[model samples]
Target: MRRVYSIVVSAGLAPALILGACLVLAVSPTLVPAELAGLVRYGPFLLALLGGVIGWWFNRGRAVFVMALLLICYWLLVGNGAGISAEGLAFLQIATLYLVPLNLLFLGFTAERGVLNPRGIARMLILGLQIFVMLMLAGQPDVGSALYRVLETRFFASTGVLGTMPHPAMIISAIAVVLLLIRHKPLETSFAAAIIAIDAATVMGAGVIQYGYLAATGVVLAGLAQEAWRMAFVDDLTGLPGRRALGHAMAELGNQYAIAMLDVDHFKKFNDTYGHDVGDIVLKKVARELARVGGGGKAYRYGGEEFAVLFAGRTAERAQEPLDALRQRIADNKITPPEKSKPVSVTISVGVCERDEDTTDPWAVLKSADQKLYRAKQSGRNRVVI
Candidate 1:
């Protein structure tokens, strides 16, 4: 159950759930009331706008670009603002069918350098250029017809399972989906969901296209939210919960919980002797051992070269055995520094305290643990004190 929960949350469960709701509504139109007719028409535009604001605020270039693309495509294909000729409309439909997946692939593969950076601006300009060229071709009936013929040409057999989607578009969407799956990060998974939604919009009837785009926009928004949360509460370098998360956990501690403070011994010396890069490797190695700590303890990166473990229902004496084992394991592990022939070992010192009659507050218990940590360092590094 825990593994399942981790997988779902890690992959942006909120967005997936939203997409599933949209799919259900699409299949059973009666579930939607007549009062929601206006919402159904305009919700995608509103949501996309909101998503754009979030992307910009968070400086997530991919989200911003994707939201903009979704808004423009929704406006062009569904809103039909220009009242173009039937041939132009048909051309746009096919063009977007191809362009959406291509844009998704580009955004999925690219790094998020930020929305206002030079590279981001270049990406935006490139997308604008494509739109301009598409509009120019769409205005010329003969050119539009020629391109439409080329785009509509089938590269594979059209089976009943494939519906009426163009083979080329299907192929592009398939490739994008497969690559996104292989990447398997939260943002990449969201992109894969969006591509699938767009493809469904293409193969299904026009009535469902808006829902598909809406789901795509929703997933992007959800991904941005998840990333922002992670940035606030997770240590990027160590991949552990950060100090803010520790504070939250501490707030919920019971009366008998244990708090252990840990610090890498002589970390500054390691950084000075080898380099900051080698120091980083040492910290990562220590963090890995801490993450695997026993006794139902949760590890957190408290700050530079320091970490904390919380044993929610355990006493200080009960926590000593596991903490000592962790210290020994880290002391036994050796790290090979770059350009160095011999491997060097890293060690950590730990101090533990539990809630008691004299120190009932969690903060006080933590402070006591820190004081004990100092004593442990004074006595000798690479040891645990309780």
Candidate 2:
């Protein structure tokens, strides 16, 4: 939770700083170099495309990923006032300031699922309706003026505590951003930031669009991409570092180190007797026990039914106590399978080897540990053999 909170806070603050800078630049365009003004003017679409690409990459072709395509379309259609009646473009500008918030809300509500689900379908329908209304209102300035007058008369006037944003749209947007931050979905948070930033650009009247908004969104997308990379190296079933990660660990280990190769005894038999689902639970339980091993041990899931524990700068004898304790914990643990009447207990066989005169290479030490593990299995499992 703390990690999630920190991530949310960081993503939230990034957009705030970005939008604030945008507003400042809008006020004092002179502070921005004339050379960079062209980039600021024409860079939003490209940056929006970059953000979309990053989001698509992290999500991995999920249906919700198509939102990126639609987002690009949104930039092309409404980002700049173009190819529309002057009065219609004015209406779109006014409508989009409020509509973007709704789009963000829709994105947050359906971050994982696509339009196939009920919530997603409904939101998309309403969003389509909003776009249709915006299109209809385009080139209709007299209606826009009259509608604002009626709306102004109907709603009760209220003053904001912060005088900088007295309008209801700004207050609603602020509330939406806070709510999205609380959800802690990285891509959703970034999407909301981009929407809010772009809308703020519209409200500021500094320019037709602010490319900085897309740039900020791209930063958030980059964070999501990083998380995706981390997830790639993590084992899905046992939540441990995978075999590839174990290779990395082996490469990092010093000459003086102990490697322990462990495997759940009769794992295949257990899987056959119980369902694979229960077998997965057993693996997860054993993984938890192995993860708690001490003596500088770091555990990894080294392929099916097998795991590696690396004790950096420790001898096999020094690491024996922790390994033995881990074996005992797995033996004693009572795991209840889903829809099963009784709890089942499982055991692990460990083979430990330390770097020595005969085994200097990490792989050599690992192979030695594996051989010892095979010996333990032959001599009745559930014990550590060195």
Give each model a TM-score. Answer: 0.92, 0.70
Q: Top lDDT: which candidate number?
A: 1
lDDT of 1 by residue, 18-70 (tens): 78988888888788899997787787899889988988898888888888888
Clashing pairs in 1: none
Query: Which RMSD values do the candidates have, in order?
Result: 2.7, 5.8
**Residue-wise C-alpha lDDT for candidate 2, range 1-386, written one tens digit per residue:** 42353444464565565567666777787887989887776555555566555544554332233244335434534455565566555555455445656556655665354345566466556656766676666547677665444323313454443322326566667777777778774456665676566655544543535544444454445445534644566697887888877887788888799999999999998889888988898899998887788778999999899999999999999988999999998899888777788988799999999999988999999999999999999999999998
> In terms of TM-score, how similar is model 2 to the real structure?
0.70
Q: What are the runs in model 1 whose C-alpha is more than 4 Å off?
A: 1-10, 81-83
